[model samples]
Target: MVGSFSDIGATSTDFCNFRRDLLAYISGADAQMVVEDMYKNKEMEPDFYFDFDLNEDRELCRFFWADTISRKNYVCFGDVMSFDATYSTNRYKLIFVPFTGVDNHKQSITFGAGLIAREDVESYEWLLKNFKTAMGYTPRCVITDQDPALKVAIPNIMPETRHRFCMWHIMEKVGDKVGNALAQNMEFRKALNNAVWDETLSVTTFELKWAKVMQEYNLVQHRWFDQMYKARASWIPAYFQDIFMGGLLKTTSRSESENSYFGKFTNHHNSLVEFIMQYNRAIGEQRYHQKQLDAKGESSFPETKTPLAIERQAAAMYTKNIFYDFQEEIWEGNFTCKITCKTNDDGGYKYTVHETGGNIFENEGVEEIPGCYIVPRWTKSACAQPMYNVVWKACSNTQGGNELRTIANQLWNEFYNCMGLANGCPTEMDIMLSTMQELKGRLQSARQQTRASTTPQSVIESILNATAPAEIQIKPPSVAKNKGSGKRLKSNKEKATEKGKKKVRTCATCDRPGHDSRNCPERKALPDE
Candidate 1:
């Protein structure tokens, strides 16, 4: 069990249990009861909010729920959230998505949860819309993975909110997209990570550092690098400095912790009603622990180690655990931060952190254990990227004729992302224009070479040896039974076990019950005589 109970939702189950138990909930009236009970609870406590969607058959297709306490928590700590469908933890195999955030204690807390029959824009849209209704306001920002559906839905649902991607999800893809060798290179990893996570860097400085990393690694021409670079404003911390995402969730992976928390309670073996019971139990444990911490934070005071009012104020403001986090920062601030760009603005002074050169905290052992969880979200610009990768290895002898087309397509897409050119700095524009000119000149020669070296391998117009679908469209034979109208099919073992015992035959002359007619005792005696 996770130490924090309010961290996640449940959705993990094996296939056998899913077919039996999940079907029972979906096809029967039990699923409706769960929603009806939620409604009755909502009526009892007006703060309780629940919404669901039904299919043509009136079966439950999706469910979203946030109780009174959950809504209250949202009012306190719902500025930024991380939510995802954890692996199935219910017998029904519905996707369990928990809307999780960090509380004042810096412990993971859940604002709401949802169960969806499928992962799609419609389901995500419904969940976000209900979340807004329950909370009675849109959050200032939200953090999520680059889920295609979510990328499309969040804007439509909450246009005012800043949607940012989780750095953890993006970093997890590094090994696959950049190849294991480069991904495993510690120097490259650290440089790239430092560039992306440094919230203190200004946008121009970040762009330059990112460009330097690409050049150092000879990844200036890499497709993935270009795509990520153009879209950096969406996910990178430097771009999201205005949003309070780092302030709220800089050190927490609420979704991961939440999954761990709820996993202890909900499992695939649970019936719909049983799962609800377990969910309640888990929430109760979480709330109770949080309350205990709140009491400790309020009643008990830690011994002040210094005369600094900031340190003393932190102790007063934060919970015991969060205060420890603050204390650690206070000790480390000597190396990381500096008062720079200080000037008098209007009636007061404006102090901005130094934004030029390398990040001051880059290599000071300041990066956390889970570097990815601390960052935030996506650009609408990359929403329609082709799902397929045309991996045209240009150096290979096995070149396709359409190789140049793919390259041209990538170039065109990148060029199309230059919507900010009119407002960009003159130096940046000069650099971009010069680079494009050089690329165009080189690409013409490269295209000629690629076309000349193409092999004449004939591509098939159709699947010559296509196979049929794996499953048979057939039904089992029914067994004939005296009592039942529709008996189940009997197996070979059943037939063998249920066969009537060999009938005893009467002897021909003595009418013996134990002997067969062909082997009668009188017949045997006559034959012997």
Candidate 2:
């Protein structure tokens, strides 16, 4: 094309410039049309949304896209979100931001996306505002890489949401702060990981262990450790474990996974139009895979390793993926741990659990390691509270508490029947419906019995025996009278039938055969006729 243009009397310098302009026009026109089509069909595609900002030259700068399915997934599983704005792909240099979560099948789900011209705080705030508006609610927690501008903007916009820095992202940078010699130290890495991943540790315990490690490594003044210790609440699991996160996310791993998955669809050489096209294709495939998982989970139940009621209950209660997690916990709780002591505390029972084999929390230089997992169990009410917590209640202290204790003991027995401590004995709408059905059944049965008793065979037989056939009588045909004199005329068929048929003589007064009322012997003779 450039050579052809040069043959048409264009200068040598204009050759490269014309080629650039042609490519720009091609990519820009397609990009603009993509956004325009999304807007044009917004009414028909109620969930489809796209917004774009233009520079002074009316060129596309920022764009946001979210379909209806993304909005609904956010509503269902958006309790915890991982928003990443780090990936800069395509020729336009736009940063890709995806709102991601985990569905019930433990699959990565994209909630929404944004593309920005810049990575400044203002761009991030705009993206977050639009995402919140599209999703209709703020997530309970948001996890992201440690971006200084995002840290400032999040508290301003999502003040109520817990903003946490991703543990994996921070851990990946540990080698940069710690010397290479210390980075390769297996013991050092193990201790640091324990401090980061152990949610059961108390704040004081974590601080002590962290201090001991720093002292042992002779890095008390390390700037990275100093900053991390100061901002520990945002990254530490011990601080926010009690908060409801819906098991959706803990780090930016979901976002990284999404990027890796989407990488196949796009690259630096692609145009904006190609990027959008590949994005749709990627999202469609992701959803298709999730649907396949959903179908598999619905059709097949997870296999149980034990006959425990709680295991069965979990399989019944949770999705297939979640049930496996629950099953693993049940297996771990029974196999690797045991109840050390049970004590009464504040109208509830506290059970101390101790790990038996391969303790996870054995520190160096300590003679005996702490293996107890402390879990506080409290009874809030009489109603059977269904809570999804790691803590298990052995008994409650309340009115009729023994019954509750018996039930708990039964559950514990079933849970640990492999080890066997002791084996012992053992809605309102449903009630109303059962009662109504019972009454209806009884009423129908009574009506059937009454009909059977009232219509006996003897009464039916007597009525049939007494019934008699009725007698038939033929009447004489009447004649039409003449106008002047009382003369009569009759049809020939009627007159002949009347003459041929024998008439039974019956008196009108007595209604008896063989006697008219005027000549009856039983009647007194009239004196003067």
For TM-score, the strongest prediction is: 2
TM per prediction: 0.58, 0.60
lDDT of 2 by residue, 1-529 (tens): 4247544655767666753544444432545445544654464455666676665655566678888777666656677788776453566566788788877666788988887776678878888878876666788899888988799888888888999999888887787678669879999999888877887888888888889988988879988889998999998887787666555435888888888888888876556655776888899899999778666755777789987776775565466766677678878867787666777767666666668764443222222212242111111110123222122223223434356768999977864762343233215445545766799789879977886776333333232221111321211111112121133466454566798797788887667888799877556454655
* CA-lDDT, candidates in order: 0.66, 0.67
Among all candidates shown, the one with the greatest lDDT:
2
Give Cα distance to truth, residue 408, candidate 2, Å: 56
* Candidate 2: 10-residue stretch with minimal lDDT: 374-383
* lDDT tens digits by residue: candidate 1, 139-237: 777877778899999999999998877777777767667775887799999998888878788999998888899899999998877887777777887
Cα error, candidate 2, residue 78 (Å): 0.4
Candidate 1 CA-lDDT value: 0.66
